[model samples]
Target chain A: MSNTPLLSTRGLTCRFGGLTAVDRVDFDVRPGQVHAILGPNGAGKSTLINLLSGELRPSEGEIHYRQHPIHGLPAHRVARLGIGRSHQKTNIFPRLSCLENCRLAARIHLGGVIASWRSRAAARQVDERAEQALATCLLTHRASTPASAMSYGEQRQLQIAMVLATAPTLMLLDEPLAGMGREETSRVTGLLRALRDDYTLVLIEHDMDSVFALAEQITVMVDGRVLETGTTAAIRGSEKVRDVYLGRHQQEQA
Target chain B: MLHRYPKRVPIIMLALTVLLVFYPLWGPVLIGDGSDFFLEKLTLMLILGLFAMSLDLLVGVVGLVSLGHALFFGLAGYTLALASPSYSAASLWWMMPLVMLVSALAALVIGALVLRTRGIFFIMTTLAFGQMLYYLVSDASFTGGSDGVFIMFKPTLAIGELTLIDLESPLQFFYFVMGMTLLTYLFLHWLIRSYFGQVLDGIHDNEHRMQALGYATYGYKLAAFVISGVLAGVAGMLAAMQYGFANPAQLGWHLSGEVLMMVILGGMGTLFGPLLGAFAYELLHYAFEHLTLYWQLLMGLTIILIVLVLPKGLAGLILDPPRLRLPRVGVGGLLRPRPAASTKARLGLAGHHKHEEG
Candidate 1:
């Protein structure tokens, strides 16, 4: 497709000392699609998200987000450019109340940083957006609870709520569903599925069934390099993908 | 944790307000000493309290341990000292804002450089800058070098020909210091509760998360640092006006340690705690000085005893209605990370890489 991708990377590479963490790779993340990056634990999926979110600098590459070169920008700068990401470990303001955490995130998108002078009426938008995010994550009931008080699964949900509150055009969720019971996994999967309508989502997740179920497109990375980028059917049906990423268990199932 | 002002808080505030207003009359009576020295000590308490409160903005709100905070305080005092006191035209109109602006600018520059570092590095860099200012004043001829500079007369307030407040009188001067303290407290109270304050609090909890959520954390921190310095400068200005002197020692690392101790002893984050800590420290010093020349030793013992007993500092025992959470070791937990900070990268940005190494 010659159409402009929401976020595109060309020869993106990151090195820690002499070791290359993320090797030169390229992909075009189309607008309004759930592009899932599937990999083993050390496949550098998290590193890719880190580079995208500006947590780590790319050793070599160009990352264009909405036609702007954002590879070298700091995390906050990237965030200001309407790109938000979540951590695999459920990053959140643990001391702050759930609503407060969301409010802090929402205010950045809804208003200026120096908003001390603005009246409550003027900042009503921030509160509304925060509440909406909470509702979307089904965390409205626990809004007043400190984030630390929430169950781990609930905190994971709060993580999504936080990124959602930022109101980004594109979201890079790092392992949005890592540790979850059956119900929470489905709930988050449902949430991710719903988010596809509003946000261009790049999710790094290990849950194959969930990825296949939710993602329209998938990128399989092996040892910091992309094995293949294709539709779920293509990835599932590929012999190499089955042998390497899926293991022999997936081949027997096929 | 549950949080609320105690029922006695309003009563305490009202009582304190009433007592301060009637201080000239009742202050002499209640102290029993009823001496000029007693009143002066009380006034010093109020000014130092303001200084401690300013440091709290950095330590408590932003979770930034600034060791060079005394730079702004001493710089403002020195500005008043170095300037020609010959001009009677310098009123509250120009002087206060001017000192505040200079101090804020210094904080801005210092903050820009120091804020890039975190934890121990941030502390050491601030300490380094604090010493630089101390030495600059101590060695500079314009600053009176180590001998220090002196203000010829206290700053007076007037509008054109109108003589509004005559600061020469000790009682009036005392009230003026108290007025500034109250004003600073009010401004800070408003600030820490504002959207900016909440954002700073979020940044303190998890900077990376705040950044990920789209906040320019560095800007917020720099702004907070400037606000903190400006308030501190205001305190220094008041102190300079009162003492009619600006010593290089005021800029020294010693003062930084003292003020940090005050914030920690009073309770790091609470608005009123620093003031209480200042009062506690000053009073103990005063009481001990009266008894013996080796007052510092006794002062140290008392502070240690007090800190050990009230781990959350004076504010925990006296001001904060709710216990909230247990106090971590380290003054206001400056050395120890906040409870939430341990899990800060819970979404696992830094942690994910550890596995990458394996």
Candidate 2:
């Protein structure tokens, strides 16, 4: 709610043995903003998200969430702090039904943590919130369907819905449209655009059109460090970005 | 839609308990000759059934397969025999309490030690500890050495100037065992349906995810282990009381193997699977022992067939797998069918409307 950015990382660094996966990467994500972190394969985009999500501990640097230090917190604690994320891989409770999946996430939002033997009232609330989340992704009809039965695109939608049920202040979406077909991608893009009003999303995406359309600000990463960060237009016209990333593709397309 | 009979489950259990309690009364007319012997066998089966259920709680539901369950069962028997007077029937009151106390203590100590390791190491360690106890009992002279201690008379309950329980009466004793089984079954059912049960399921599915989700997986696992251990101990105490003797064979690895087979045969995770498996297996054993002298061979072959044929156990086939159903929603918020199916359902709805109009 404050003018301060929703999240800020100062000198964030991570090391795996002798290799550095994320190196002194300083980044800030403002409130109610769509900030996309763009990079090619093996560019530490995933590593950065893992660090921010508290899946991996940083070797050095501080991460402040809503102006409070949250670097060393566990994944659930980070989630409880109003930060929700979907994994790069379709990470969900596979055997559970679509509604059950959302219910699991929704329970995190409804007062206390949900255990297996929850009261009927808590169970009902979970079901209700899960249905609401499923509606948001237009998959409410498939609420009783198992996760395994869903198509790849629907699985992606369910993943987003699960994250949404957590009621996060900032959503870290890792490749939301990674393996979607054209129609599916457009549908998801439209959905993301629609959600822009209620959510401040930080997306790591490969789809240029969706990124450009949805993101107000873009930061480029190469070899685990932030190469540049600016408005979409500024990033588009950056000579260094063109020479390093876009040069080969721009020429080939032309 | 056909409604599930959730209430039927408990009703059936209550009926079965009543039948078991009065089994001797009817067993004489049904089985004909050696009715008392058969009832005794049933009592043994009931105790073993409880033992099997305890294992199922750990292996089937909690996802911790243990091979040393008989250790608790046999240990309690040993403790009861050692405490009771050898010259006469052990005082049922003293021996029963002692069996429970000693068995629980042994299980707690053993469970704590074995639970520290996991996977194959845990299995092997528990097996070793059980074998060690068996060996110690077999070699010890004061504990009747390898031959085991016997009871001169069945235990009886005495009240001042009033008669109470006569353990020699098969009907009275059978009811006692039945009561214990029902209590154990109900307690276990409640336990697995609790929040603790849910966490165990989560741990079973993905332990790391549970830890990341802020659950102390270690504490949850330990609690489940202790609960299973205590249940096994109670089964052992009842076994010792029923037989009026404790044998070194009670501690043998075969005892553990038999209980495990019962769990697997009945359906590891299913609620009543243990009871089913125990009864079926025991009855089969009785029939085989009478029909053929080589009952052990038949028992081994039958267990092999059950394992090979139904790895998920009998429960998976009988109980039906858990299914997910959609919650009822407001009419306006009803989920639209897939765009492809929408037209067909809409046509069906329209047909009903037109019929009403006509």
Candidate 3:
């Protein structure tokens, strides 16, 4: 378990008709490491994340987590096996209170959903854990607030908190900073930094600044293929990465 | 702090008290009075109310709008008829439990199979399964082979005194039915407010989100479907007992349609909505039966009118549906902008954390 990558994908390929969404992509995230997958639009970064999280099955290759294959398992089963994923869309339970969203997720982690319904004692304990999760997410003040009524940034935070409540050893975040204002992003980034030691995080982001700032290891993808993977500094220094991604920076200056 | 007891108990008790007390006194027609017509109507209403609530669990709470609930009810009726020694002879009290168990088992098997499909496919699949059961019972000689079976006696208590429930006396049967109906309501209310109930709501709002939260939504939906089926089945058994026989007509599509109408008319999701719908529906049936022989035609028209006019159902008119309300977050709570460009601020902190770990 010490040497094993929290999540590793080998030759993972997903094809839709004649077009390939992800083509023979190999990726890995070491334990407690923040691995960022960076790509332009339609670059298959999301498809790769989807495959790793068991939301989509690979047409080729295998996905291993903690040395066990998890390629074709249902998303819920994958979550149960210690991988928590937040969607690109803010997908927290809208009707549920902010606390309830986290609590239900935590309850799933404890495997008490079945007994919790009939047993008052079990439900009380789950509620307490849910409250604790809310506090951990800096959402204690809005514990009873419905997720539907939260500001866009708050909703995003709640989505991440909901995933955290699952108690996953590995976290898969698809574009966590997609729609956030600068302050919100900073607050969330601070929270993400605090979370670094507790779980392995795989983040997909178009925000270069956030990616460059957070990623220990960075993988760049283009047209469904992995172009490069290395330390962020190494990747930033690479001529290919500059030509493929940072060319836009030159174009903007021109 | 409010987690110690079932959340909806007090509300259910209040409703039951009003139903049991006022309805018997001024609601007209007592059982055992040669024409205990009103009492009989009340008993029928209670049975239908139970049926509607069962359907509501699937549709209102679980978001599975099913059309085959009556199949469980009708099948239970047939079970009681086949098991009893002559529809007139009193069946043992334990047999009622047996009937409910069998009906519930049928629901479980059926729910498990059909729950695999969703949306229109789910509705159509359940209807097909229900029709298959109806035809099977109608054709089978053991269940009176389409003509239906008559009970020789009412159900009797299995206790020391061998207390037989006298269905012949409308008042006794009325009280018994009322007690069972109230119990079913309470049980269902408890179930809906429990942790299981919240999960059901989650599944309803967003199943994908629930699954991601680590819940096996499929299992929860199947369980809810079974619970609803069993309740409907019990109501069916009671209906058979009251009517003194089980008929092929009881298993018909029209009966299924009628129950759907009752559910919608009362209010699809409200706890007392179904009971109110049943009461209104039964009263309409009573009036129509006296006024015209083609009463079903008028009843069908009435339901269509109700659907067109009050799509939210009766309960929606009286009460505001629950809404999500977030208490305002004051300005002091929101994080203020940092001086050195927030992204850079975050980057420095993230870098420091990483370096410390290294």
Candidate 4:
């Protein structure tokens, strides 16, 4: 919070007619920090991430990144300014090979359309970045396999690799652990831990154990409202958080 | 470096090219002696192939099914007809460049408006634009209205006193179309292989994801549209010069649908598929008409049968034949149905193998 925040929002709000999906939420993520947004169903975590990522513009309030206002910019422009987002579902080019998927992501950051007219291999840097990201996600062996041919877990990992290939300074990941076996969950959890060293991360997940283990700062939400933003230990110990979001999930787990 | 080398691709392309380049000369012997009709249809097939290739650029590669593609192609033909000796006596030099420029600019304008919408809306907008052009041309007196326009004298290519390839003779013109088609193919082939091509493919696969990855999806789609439109225009220009006429039929919705059918029938994503699709469709149309007046009904049935049987287009069958493996017989004897338990055990092993693949 002391060092210039990578991304910050003030009173950001989104409404769906009668329902306010995101209700004037306020939070800031510092550089290289793992920030988790925890909430029960309908707490509007995805909506908040969408609003911040410029997929949906805020009806009210401001979002600043690198000390510049960016609430109204288009999603692509927001990404170019270094905020890459992974969807809640594993979203990737299904027909394209896993390496090609990551390569496409890297190519957008590397010169885009102008560089597109040359053979993809000619851009050595793009390949290296794609390979590096693939390796990080443990998808190197499946690099030549079509994304459609991949398992649910592999596709999920490939989605993260895609985000990483873009070389974003910050990544907004929505449910990175959503539909995974125990081993897959542990693999992704480890991948997230390593990723936090270089890029600021804002993760939205329902997994309490990974959230507690990885998050430096945790923001607990209830019914589209940010109830508290505190350290992992503080949020875990807070009576209010325990009674609201974690209590419900912990009981379900038990 | 990332693309794997295919050993047979170059050889196949070379054989197809050589056969096409010499078709007019030697084709008569194979079909029947002195059949100008065969040459004419084959030439038309090549031009339609080019048109379909351009559309496939949008439909297959970019996932935009543009219904306005004929507008660019027909407009180029219209411009050439008016510029030629029948109207203003404009030379081919100035006439061709001016018309191509006009068509490209028109594509840019239409692409800007159309690329804004998506899905059925985008398809509808393109259809509207194509119909608008068709109506404007058919209703206008300068365009000869419903009567259409003709090119009396084929434009000659010359630099000062030195003459290059003349556009008058059918043989020369066929060669011109061939050369243009080849150039278009080579250029597009290079483009699809490029990084830009990959991005366009990505956009088709998942536009939202590409945008999230920092791609200006709209801009790339528009550029692709214009490129496709320009290529279609070039094909239209060739068609006009070949037939010595430009009519409302060139710009009509039927033409748009015909080319779309060609792209789908050939294969959507691959470059050569459109060419093969155009040839097959044209040949079938010719053959059916010769057989009976109910050619339309027959053609429709054939297309349905093809879809049912092939599933993939004509090119897809040749290029990537679907695997059809039969069950292996046991060493002890020929295969036969086993008892319940053994049947289940055998099926389980096969199921396990399929599961690993899946």
Candidate 5:
């Protein structure tokens, strides 16, 4: 992997009214690495992801992706610049089929005014990309099924499939396993591991086991600030991260 | 619902097309010489149907409920009247395109401003823009100050020395309108199944997700608004040709509301529904008028009944018959609250794990 970070934030901050959801934080994700962001609820983990994805404008900071400043750019522009994100809350077009959901994301790379008179099915490349994404996420069997009809785990897979279909080099995923059962969680973990070879991932997850297994780098946050940033083994050995976030999580599990 | 009975829908549509195409021939036999009057009415209905269909592109497909749709419709009529010489007819070739261009420009400007807002604010802003235009035409002296302007002659379509369509005759005008309506329906059918329409569907379903997928959704919406405006302009120009007058009322909010009602009455998302609605609404208006002086009251009651009974509108009857079961009328039934099960079922969560997070 290159030493130059694919995406890096310098002094990033987001304040909602009087509450600073994300304090001034410097963070980075090297190319082709699974970088996991772990924190308790309201640790500004999702907020940081939102900032990187351009869903929310930072109050203070510069976000550089591939050395291009992208802080103030809108989400669509950020996405066009090869960044994609999945929502914490399952955000997919529920009424549309799984294939259609992926097709909509894949077609963005076609990059022109959509021909209003042509059939959507005629775009063979978009369909192929969509099918490939579904296949990657093991959702190819559910291609014709409406998203709402799928199980919650399948829906989460569809969400990742949609981002995958966009063909972004860097992906910001918020809690991809937030509500999945054990089997579903393991399946998604496997999917993420497979994805690690192809794309740089910034994951915000509460599932510590999967976080340790899938991520090469880990960042722990507490109360809108980064507590630690290190390799998985380094973070596992950190005292401050244990006391602030992981200790409480383990206690709850116990 | 429409897709469920796909085989039947085409057959029904084919039958309807056959009926409409042969109406000119068969209509006179049934109505005698008064068929001309009915034909004129039908032509007007077709024009309004086109208008409603254009609005549906925004309201139904793009999920933009624009209350200012009449602005384009009325503006096109005024354009035709203004461009035509007081003593001579204008060429259909140029005037039609000019009016459409004007309407498109207006939509582009207004959509750019109003699309920045969401939901109720968007609706109000559109309504406000439409009202502003209405007053501009109503109070302005050059626009005849609510007295309206009249077109002296219908537009002529000619290729050099040969006249292709003399839009003056009632029979010819009816056929022209029918042809236009068919073309619009076919075009819209193809459009809604296209890549552009799929993006629109995604926007309608979840705009934020579409944005995350890297679509500049604003551009798509603006394009839809402009395209819809241009189509509404065509309908407006046709109306002016038929009536030979452009009035302030055409630009009024009531007309906009009426077109909205037509869209709802037919079915919001179905391209064919708006046309069905326009015909049904106008036919009801005509029938009710002859039945009593208090026709509006009867119309109001009928509409309320239809809405309560057929929540999906008239198209629902053909699309999904099973769901159109009438509510049982009983004192206990009326008093009892609806079961939550049905709501869950409607959401497609009937057999799934209810507590699972979406």
Candidate 6:
């Protein structure tokens, strides 16, 4: 992987009223690496993902993708710039079929203008891309099923599939394994591992085992601020990270 | 596209089309008395159906419920009245396009401002703009104030030596309106099944998801608004031509509310539903008017009953019939305990059940 960050943020901050959801934070994800963001609840990991995905504007900071500043851009514009994100809430179109959910994400590359009166079936490229994404996420069998009809695990897979369909160069996933059962978690971890070689991933996850298994680099956040950033080995051995995060976990386990 | 509809819906739609096609021929004989009056009423219903269907494109498909949709309808009618010369008929070829353009421009401007807000705020803003126009025409001297203006002559469609459509004749005008309604239906049918329509459906289902998927939803909504406005304008122009007059009432929120009611009464998302709604609403309105002085009360009760019985509206009766099931209210049912699972799971299963039925 290249040393140059595919997406990098300097002094990124987001404050909601008096509460600083995400304090001034400097973070980066290099190309083709699974960079995991680990934090406890309310540590502003999701907020950081929201800022990077352009879902929320930062109160103070600069976000650069490929060395060009992209702060203050709308989510749609940010997505167009090859960054995609999945929500912690599994935000797929529940009423639409799985294929349609992927097709919508895939069709963005077809341009925004309403120039055609032909049937959606005629847009073979969009359908193919959608199908391909479903295949990649192992959701091809559920293509015709409505998203709401799918199991929670399958829905999570559909979420990643949707991001995949966008053909994004960089992906920001928030809690992809948030509520998955053990089987679903491993399945999604497999999917993420498969995706690692093809696209850069910024993952915010509570599951440390998957984070350690899949992520080459890790960033831990505590109270909306980055606690530390290092390789998996360094973070696993870091004194500060253990004292604040992992130590607490070990104590609870004991 | 055809496969998406219920089996009975397509057959029923075909039967309806056949009935409409033959209505102008046999309708007069069936009614026997006041054939001309009935014909005019039917024509007006068709025009209003077009208007209601246009609004459905916004409310049902794009998920925008504009309370001032009548603005385009009235504005176009006024355009027709003002553009017509006192002694001569306006050219249909030029005037129709001009009126539609005017409505489109108004929609573009209004859509830009109101689209920034969503839900109830959007509705209120649209209603405010509509009311503003209503007062402008009501109080402005050039627009004939509250008195309104008359199109002295009907628009004419003519070639070098041939006249194709003469809107002055009731029968010809009726056929013209029927043709326009069919065209709009077909156009919308094609549009809603297209890639553009899929995007609209996506927006309606989950706009935030669509935005995250990289769609500039504002532009799509604006386009739908303009298209809907242009269609409503066509209906408005036809109404003005038929009545030979334009008034502030046409632009009022009352008219907008009526059209919205028609959409809800028929079925929101289905294009054919609004047309069905228009015919049903107008026919009921005509029937109730003759039956009692408090027709509005009866009408309100009927609407409430329909809403309670067929929540999806009149179109839903055919497209998606509600399952009839007896309520479990006997002693055994009352004694039984409710499921202890989370309500979310129950709701999800209930949604799935409904989806299967539909």
How do the residues A147-220 of candidate 1 rate in per-residue lDDT, one tens digit apiece? 76677788899989988988898999988888899999999999988898888999998777898999989999
lDDT of 5 by residue, A1-254 (tens): 68999989999999999999999899989998999999888889988988888889999989999898999999899999989999988888766789988988888876433531254554777888889999999998999997877888998999999999999999999999988999999999999999999999999888888999999999988889989999999999999989888899999999
- Tell me, by lDDT, which candidate is best: 6
Off by over 4 Å in 6: A112-122, A250-254, B1-3, B323-358
DockQ per candidate, 2 decimals: 0.41, 0.14, 0.28, 0.50, 0.49, 0.49
RMSD of 5: 4.4
The complex in candidate 2 yields a DockQ of 0.14
TM-score (chain A only) of candidate 2: 0.94
Worst 10 residues of 4 chain B by lDDT: B1-10
Give the clashing residue pairs of candidate 3, or none. Answer: B86-B152, B87-B150, B87-B151, B87-B152, B88-B151, B88-B152, B88-B153, B89-B152, B89-B153, B90-B153
Instruction: Please state the CAPRI-style docking class of candidate 3.
Output: acceptable
Give the winner by DockQ: 4
Please rank every candidate by lDDT, starting with the best: 6, 5, 4, 1, 3, 2
The number of clashing residue pairs in each candidate reads: 7, 0, 10, 2, 0, 0
State the lDDT of candidate 5 residue by residue for B187-300, as single tens digits.
Answer: 888777767888887788678778888999999999999999999999999999999999998988989999998998988888778888998999999999999999999998
How does candidate 3 fare on TM-score? Answer: 0.87
lDDT of 6 by residue, B1-358 (tens): 1117766877887898788778767887898778879989999999999999999999888889989999999999999999889998889999999999999999999989999999999999999999999999999998999989988989898886588977788888998999999899989988887678888887886677788889999999999999999999999999999988999999999999999999999999898899999999999999999999999999999999998998888887876455445558776865555454345446555544543332
Reference-based lDDT, residue B112, model 2: 74
Query: Which CAPRI quality tier does the interface of model 2 achieve?
Result: incorrect
Candidate 3 wrongly placed segments (more than 4 Å): A1-3, A117-125, A248-254, B1-20, B27-35, B87-92, B162-165, B289-301, B321-358
**Model 3: per-residue Cα lDDT over B312-332, one tens digit each:** 676654443333344438874
Which stretches in model 1 have alpha-carbon errors above 4 Å? A1-3, A119-122, A248-254, B1-4, B32-34, B87-90, B160-162, B319-358
DockQ-derived CAPRI band for the predicted complex in model 4: medium
Clashing pairs in 6: none
Which residue pairs in candidate 2 collide? none
Model 1: per-residue Cα lDDT over B236-324, one tens digit each: 88888888889988888889999999999988888788888898889788789989999999989988998898887877776434444
